[model samples]
Target chain A: MKSSRPPMPQLLEQVARSLAARKDPALTGIDVETLCAQLRERPPPPPAQPRWQDALIEAQIPEGASVLDLGCGGGELLHRLIRDKSVRGQGVEIDFEAVSQCLTLGVPVLQTNLDEGLREFPDQSFDYVVLEETVQTLHQPLRVLNDVLRVGRYGIVSFPNFGSWRVRLSLAIEGRMPSTPALPYRWYETPNIHLFTLLDFLELTSEISARVVRGFSLVEGVVRPLGLNDNLEADESLLIITRDPPLA
Target chain B: MKARLRKYDPPNSPTSVGWTKAFTWRLTPPDTPWQLECGGHLNEVTVEYETYGELSPARDNAILIAHALSGDAHVAGWDRDASDTHRPWRKNKPGWWDAVVGPGKAIDTRTFFVICANVLGGCYGTTGPRSICPETGRRYGLSFPKVTVGDWVRLQARLLDHLGIERLHGVVGGSLGGQQAIEWAMAFPERVARCIVLAASPRLSAQGLAFNAVGRYSIMNDPLFLNGDYEDGQGPDAGLAAARMLAHITYLSESGMHQKFGRRRRVAHGPKSGFGVEFEVESYLEYQGRAFVERFDADAYLYITRAMDYYDCAESWGGGDLATACRRVRAEMLIVSFSSDWLYPRAQCRDFAIHLCRAGRPVTYVDVPSNLGHDAFLVETDAVGRLISAFFNPARKGWSI
Candidate 1:
């Protein structure tokens, strides 16, 4: 088989880079007091969840439930689950800064690309696979959603609504891609390539033979059961969806 | 406080733990007996162990270090008279993972109390096949009870209990040691707060089993084996050497071997037997085998390799369920895999991390790209050490600083 790794010289260079980048070279000499003091100065991370984050997780989680947070930035949501709901929490995030933040909080996180598909995990491994505010940025949303349903008993997805009335007003008046409180980035720079509304999500789920078991809408950081006008009124959505059961 | 540069050993004087220290805990009569995995039992088990740092008042901050197949309690450090001339290839050989477990090391001794013990089936002063059996007044030899990674973890726990340590702040091990670390978290989930497993798989690969089996057969086929009944000092050294040579192959990668030895001949002008020791690789392997047999027990090697082969995290608490097996562990895990480790490949280690996630356990996985094969877990300490230190220093989701 062909070599899957870099040549020896390149590998040595990589090793050299790591050795040089170590926080402390005194692998056996530094004192504990100095290390602990250095750790403390690293400003304590935010102690509580933001309003939007709290609203996104307001849905009741059953006791002993297991949750996986996709794009679990700093693991704030998962940490909250372990603390308040007393459930197990896991995360899949790729960003280094975010992963380090998650590590500092002591959250179990897989530093892997979500877009590659959750092929590594077994079927229905988690009670709930949560994709909060990260679905729009996904390169393969349809495939990821399908994998989510397959890997989790229940998949909870939350994302900013592209169909909000404010978004429509901006697009209608200015004739440019809308940027609102939800869609905070300009169209050219936004990471959310597949920005779709609640109606679009529901239609896509149905198209893929999945069922939305319980759907809720969050408006101005307040979550409530989904209403007919939620597609136009709600700023975001939190939907508990699953693949439709096979018919006999 | 900086560690004042103290005395150094000969051979260029590499930095040491900066002091002379040796800790031993030998379990005798009053000590609790360890029930074996194969139905046999030992009433008294002597566990030669070394400790670093002071245990916290809450008995936390204790990290149990499980050595690999050939490793001993000497995880890192050098006693005053400890010699480093075991091998001609290495200079000032301190502990196996000295770079990763010192004062400012990843498993920093200054911040966390560390305890590394010679495993039950180990030849390093632990009760092994070479130890005299109290019942028979003879070495157990090949008759040593079949032990598993689970058995090793059980005995290691007793060591903790004897030390008045109710729980381990973390448990860390590489290769076979990693298997024991996993078993510790599984068998006694409440006792371990964190688990660091390096270059290990949940289940032994078929290739791994094949290699181990070959090693076993090499020793058994030797006439000097004497059916595992040979008297002490008269045992089969050649057979043990052959077995170790076989095992050493599995521990390294083809690329690594090529990088280290290549096709160079051992002698420029040499008379050689046509069928033996032609290449430099053969000479290297032979030297490793000879050196290994001197420091290890053939029977102990047999026992430990068997223990490693029998390990499968999915089989026990999970009942063929990875997630279920994971639910049995409360410790957050840092699973590391080397890129070139064919013995326990990166894919398997990644799957382990995935399984832990599936089980809803907190887990982190770091891939250390290397050409060092499975042995990288022991030698490639720079990145691995940093990962461990970073993983351990942070408090878990429920833990308070």
Candidate 2:
């Protein structure tokens, strides 16, 4: 997906143009072209990719498809989908502040807890149900997963992998609950009540008679193909859950 | 000079719409009588309505606000002609919902044309129990036909037609008004684009019915009630005061009352209050009751509360099934319930949203946390206003962070 943030060159040019046009006494001594050159000579930033949101878009959801986002935080992903993919999106968020943000983003949202399940939605009501990075925080993650799959044909879920090497190393060496970039919380203050690895999630799908159509390992903010040791290597996992397994 | 200042001055807010006047429209004439849901008809009906802001050229920006029990058409702005209109109750303050309906407020008067009308059975400047019956040439005190929430919506549609508004951008209300808002979507599926129902349910609860029954009983048992034909200003003041006092208790939560009054005694008075006012809470309720009797009509109260009691969305729209009833709504729905509002409650509003969803309607439900009970919809302006303004104009960039 295209980033709304302008590239470095375009941003610098915009700043330079504004500076050159200004007649303010304080800015008169500043040279616009020199500033632009100084800013651009720095190391080029990495390509903006591998956010769970970007990974979800890579799943190639059809244009104008109906999307329901459970626990849509400030509706950033849903808004991105609507703007870029022209998808009709709805969001369910439990926080009022986040719900207000979703409204301002022009995404239809309901303020509801996920633990209660998506009983408001009819069966197969949407083309895709995205539960990004919210499964572990729920009291009944399995129950919500069942409902998510029941409500939409495809369920795209992303969560922090507890089996990541960094987390394991932290726990083993320090002898305390681990805190990584993905699960950045102390034991008592953590919102993540249920912790599971990538393999545990894949196992959960099979137990519920669901199948994983696609899986991505996101390590250090880079998306990679699911690997044999991904359960211990990946920081986060993204999966496309469906009712039937993929063709051989 | 004091009365002049009170009647003519606008509110202190810069966004105030200034002073407003109530306008009368002959909505139903003798030839085109309004049909009632209770199998009755009324002819030569007049409606008192007030409008704020300009209608968009496309006429789609009109929002009709339905008032709750004891509310009137003066929904925003100070009533300039309150004395002339004989609605002295409106002179001292701006509209009941002034907090949320100003130029830059939630239901922004700058962008949307806001219209509020006194209900058909209302006491304030509308054809109610106080209005003379065109056929009998007498006041329709006990004679007024039992009106329903459906009747109110149908009449509102007629008012819209008279105003040349083909469709509404939105309809909003709290309590009884919220029920009307829902009824608008169900009754005129093609007319409304959005509907916001706050602090209301599909029907009044059994406990609510019990309270209304006792209030009506108080009014009826009064000697001055005189079978609803007594002279004006001499009819059931005591009974009406008692009724208002009882109903006011239901509109506030125990926590709110505790925070406001606690168990503290009135410090100014001695402790020798046998049945008189000793507790501050008692004095507050007495003032509320006395103030209500000065403004509202006992007969209109009976009709309105009865109408509220009779409202069953499933029974009226569906054949005893809520999901079937929900299918009639075509507008996007926003249902809000205050957390401490036992009068309507959050659970019932959630059920309403669930049914709407089951019927394939696009709905958003929020339970706003407040200890103000049902009154929170009116008092908790900042939170409610943000939610409303965002709902109405979603997708606008640079909304407050």
Candidate 3:
């Protein structure tokens, strides 16, 4: 299908310029100073304090252990871990801007959606796979949990406890969606899709034959020992689970 | 340091390597038979390479640059003459990626020692189809046992070992070269510190294999081929030319063709055309094919394309599992793909990137927009070079700049 037309005007112009120019555009190489200027324009994110989940997980993670944080938003907690705990911190964040922010902070982060599962990694590649305040927002929480346990030696699962007394009271008495400090979203525009309580999460781990290594309960941003009615009283809950090794 | 079609240099004419020098490594290790993927073995193999810049005292800043199909060891600059006259390839030819491999360019020879080697089953100085077979005392020609990407990678590792380089700062390559880079990182994980893979995937696509199959068929069906036994003045020039033309098509973008050649014919006079080249693209392809026929060996083409086709790094390492195969890699990976490369396609490279990520390996994947097709890595200089330098900042590691 060859027609008898002349070379395109754009093509002719480019060739003419290419022939006339001494320093070809393709060979001019990047300007390091310009890159530095551009990078300076977007200053690194301000320093921030660690999340409550960081303290909860930090107590268990040994120094120099490899830790991967799934749904690591802006990688702040991972940055703190790398800085203070002497751990190798890697993060998988879904948000593009958040990943860029992480890069600015010098925290290693990969962009990927958690709902699709962590099928990219081999078995037990990391010491810990953490999902802080993010599991309830996932599309396939069960499959993601399986993936977390498959890749990391220890899996840390933390979420806002939906069965907390405040949430229960808000829903039952006021007949409105809970607006607690942790679950800071309206009913119509909330990202928390499969929200579950501490009791429900425990039941799930047991159903899958997962061995519970440790647990934590936080009420009103403060770490508190779980009582008999922890599911109803606690605002936030965390668990450490070790998956039984796959069949040989 | 421009990326352009090299000016015509007469074959056998004196030439000069403008920016770099070359060397040779004899790959003969005791008890290791230089085993290849297709069950072939070479006892004594010679590898020709070009080195740039000075190596660090710690020997940690060495980077291996793998050449693509039809590419030789002359990656940057031109060597007019080699002290080793036994080498049969042109020494003075300008390097394929000269713009990207210079002193302050993307790979930046000023900061790291760069090593570019001619691959096995190539027509260059390496032990390939044109090299003399020790047993027969003649050229290997078609007798050169089929080689694979795995063979290229293994022989390269031996060459590095001979150089006393315990570990490489990075393994960098594009196209077929990228395949070797991935294999190096996967097979000899401890040796490679980083992988700079541009426009490459872990395995060849079905369509890519089909394209290569057509090229092989064209060569094998030629009357002058004589089952790859043709020599001297008698060779399969026509078949090889056709194969090169086919390959050239895959290396170009539709947008590029439309922008550059379009429906443009070679001549504007009254139409009385019969069978000759009518369009500009046709003429360009013909010239490319003829120039390639003058330089490349037909037998080498058959073996190398087959090697590229047979390459399945994931299957070779972990028995059909990609993630498991990549688990051994210790180097951080930087993967780049072009938008116009329909040949390798973004989906394939993206899948590879995703696997690297899932394996918990450090990776940064960039999809750059371009009209240069598969050759964008070689041509889209300013943008690609900046991306590479930014991604490969050794400044953070406290390496002396």
TM-score for each predicted model, relative to the true structure: 0.72, 0.88, 0.68
In candidate 1, stretches whose alpha carbon ends up further than 4 angstroms from where it belongs are A1-66, A73-87, A94-101, A112-128, A132-140, A149-202, A209-248, B1-16, B19-34, B81-91, B229-235, B258-280, B313-324, B394-396, B399-401
The stretch of ten residues in a row with the least summed lDDT in candidate 1 chain A is A1-10
Angstrom error of the Cα, residue A127, model 2: value is 2.8
Instruction: Write the residue-wise lDDT of candidate 2 on A89-120 in tens digits.
Output: 77888998888887666666778888884966
Clashing pairs in 1: A108-B363
Colliding pairs, model 2: none
Per model, kept true contacts as a fraction are 0.48, 0.48, 0.12
Error of 3 at A170 (Å): 22
Model 1: per-residue lDDT, tens digit, B154-268?
8789889989999888899999988888888899999988899999978889999998999888888889888887776677788889988888887888999898878778776
Count of residue pairs whose backbone atoms collide, per candidate: 1, 0, 11
lDDT tens digits, residues A56-88, model 1?
564556756888778888887777777777777
* Best DockQ among the predictions, by candidate number: 1
- How big an interface RMSD has model 2? 5.2
Q: Please provide, for model 2 over B143-169, each residue's C-alpha lDDT reduced to its tens digit, 9 standing for 90 to 100.
A: 988999998888889889888999998
DockQ of candidate model 1: 0.25
Model 3, CA-based lDDT: 0.76
Candidate 1: residue A50 lDDT (0-100): 40
Q: Give the lDDT of residue B375 in candidate 1.
A: 88
Give the whole-model CA lDDT for all candidates, comma-separated. Answer: 0.76, 0.81, 0.76
